[model samples]
Structure formats: structure tokens, C-alpha cells
Target: MIGQRRHFQVAHRPRNDDESILPLINIVFLLLIFFMVAGQLSAVDPFEVEPVESAVDGQPGPDEFMVIVGTEGRLAVNQDETDLEGMARLVAEHLQRHGDAARVRVKADGRAEAVEVVGILERLREAGVERIDLLTVPET
Candidate 1:
């Protein structure tokens, strides 16, 4: 009996490759869900814009319209890229649909040409946008 060989049994099976990464997949999915729920996702602009800094702060209204003017004279109306003519047409259409209460805000890049910015403002005003504001970030 002492010379007899003892048989050892394995208690658990070895994990598969997919099973090894299950915890990692779960963690990644949890992080993605957390950001989607906790983060405030807004419409992105067509191009990058660094708004000029100002000393004063302005309270934006709920019905405000956003107009983006990029450094290279690129224009966007509420995230939709368009030319000056298209912007005016869109602004006019928006006014007709939402009424004059919807104030327009021009977010021009700091390096944007002043003449172009002024021209855009002029075009917007001609489109019957009465209350147009220049959006500026608070100076640090």
C-alpha cells in the first residue's frame, strides 16, 4: 500500500483567454457608461475657436443662437458650416420660425480678422437679428 501511486485531482479548470479579459472589458464598459451619463455632451463646433477674453461676463439666454467664426474666416451657424450668405439665410429662417426673441451670439476666434467678424455681424443684423451679442470668455 505504501508503494502504491497517489492520484492528484485538479480543483479548478484553467481560464480561457476570453475569460481572462472579462474583468478588463467590464471595467472599460463601466467607465464609458459613467462618462456618458455624468458628462454634459454638447454639439461640437466645425472648427477650433479661441474666443477673445473680456473683463465682463454675460448671461446667455436659453433661446440664444450660436454663430462661430473661425480664424480663417470659416463660419458656422449653430455648428453647421456655411458661407456668409448661407448664415444670413439660416438666421433669417430661424427668426421666422422661433421669433425675434432668439438672440444671436457671435463667437469669433481671437485671431480672426476683425473686418471679417464685422462683416458677419453686419450680415446677421441685416438678416433681422436685432439682439446680437459678441461672446467672450472671462479673463483669467
Candidate 2:
């Protein structure tokens, strides 16, 4: 037996992970793109301004306009901090551009005084806005 020659054969399978890993990476990239695109488009105001709560809810139009009034009565339009005069100008321009189709919404801080809010409303009225909508959070 020692003198006789013996032949031994061994079969090996190579690891094949490229196929599975490729699909996994592709899915990850797709999810990353989806999240990047779907992130919130609304811009946050510079100062904290909690909106007043409202029981009535109305759907705003597509070309909706929003004006932010801070707790200190500072005005911000389109996320651009400005004076009350600038806010009025912007609102008037938006209304002129979109005509009656434009819906203007005022987001005022809950701590804001009624007089300040009324003043803003009066300015909107002066801007030729027939009716202005006040934005509020619904009680949950």
C-alpha cells in the first residue's frame, strides 16, 4: 500500500456575494434619494411663534401666501424678516400677482396681542385683500 500511488481530488465552491451586495447597495441608494427629495419644504421662522388654536379649518389654495408675526410683532414674509411696511408690500404684490386666487394666511404667535393682530389685519385690508385667513393649530 505504501508503494502504490493514490490520487486525491478536492472540489471547492467560491464565495459569491457580489450579486446580493449589489442589490442591497442599490436599494440603499434609492432610499437615500427618496428621503432627500421628500424632506419638509416648509421653512421655519427665525423666532419662535406659536400659532393660535382654531376650531375652524379651511383648506388653503395652491398659491397660498403666509406671513409670520413674531411675539414681538416683527413681520416676516416668505421667511424673509422685514418690517410691517415690507410685509404689506409683499402681501399686496402676491395678491396682485395671483389676484383673488391667492389666499393669504397670517401665522401669529399665541402670545401676540389682539391689538397687534388686528393691526395686521387692518393692514391686509388696506392692501386690498378682501379677506385674510389666520393660521392656527387644531387642538388634538
For model 1, residues 1-140, the per-residue Cα lDDT tens digits are: 79999899978978679988999999999999989986755556789999999999986654568899998778998878988888878888889987958688999999999999999988887778888899999999
Q: Which ten residues in a row have the lowest lDDT in candidate 2?
A: 57-66
- Candidate 2 lDDT tens digits, 61-125: 43468788887777888777899889878987888798877667888899999899889989888
Error of 1 at 138 (Å): 0.7
User: What TM-score does candidate 2 get on C-alpha atoms?
Assistant: 0.78
List residue ranges in candidate 2 displaced over 4 A.
Answer: 1-13, 59-62
Candidate 2: lDDT of 72? 72
lDDT of each: 0.86, 0.81
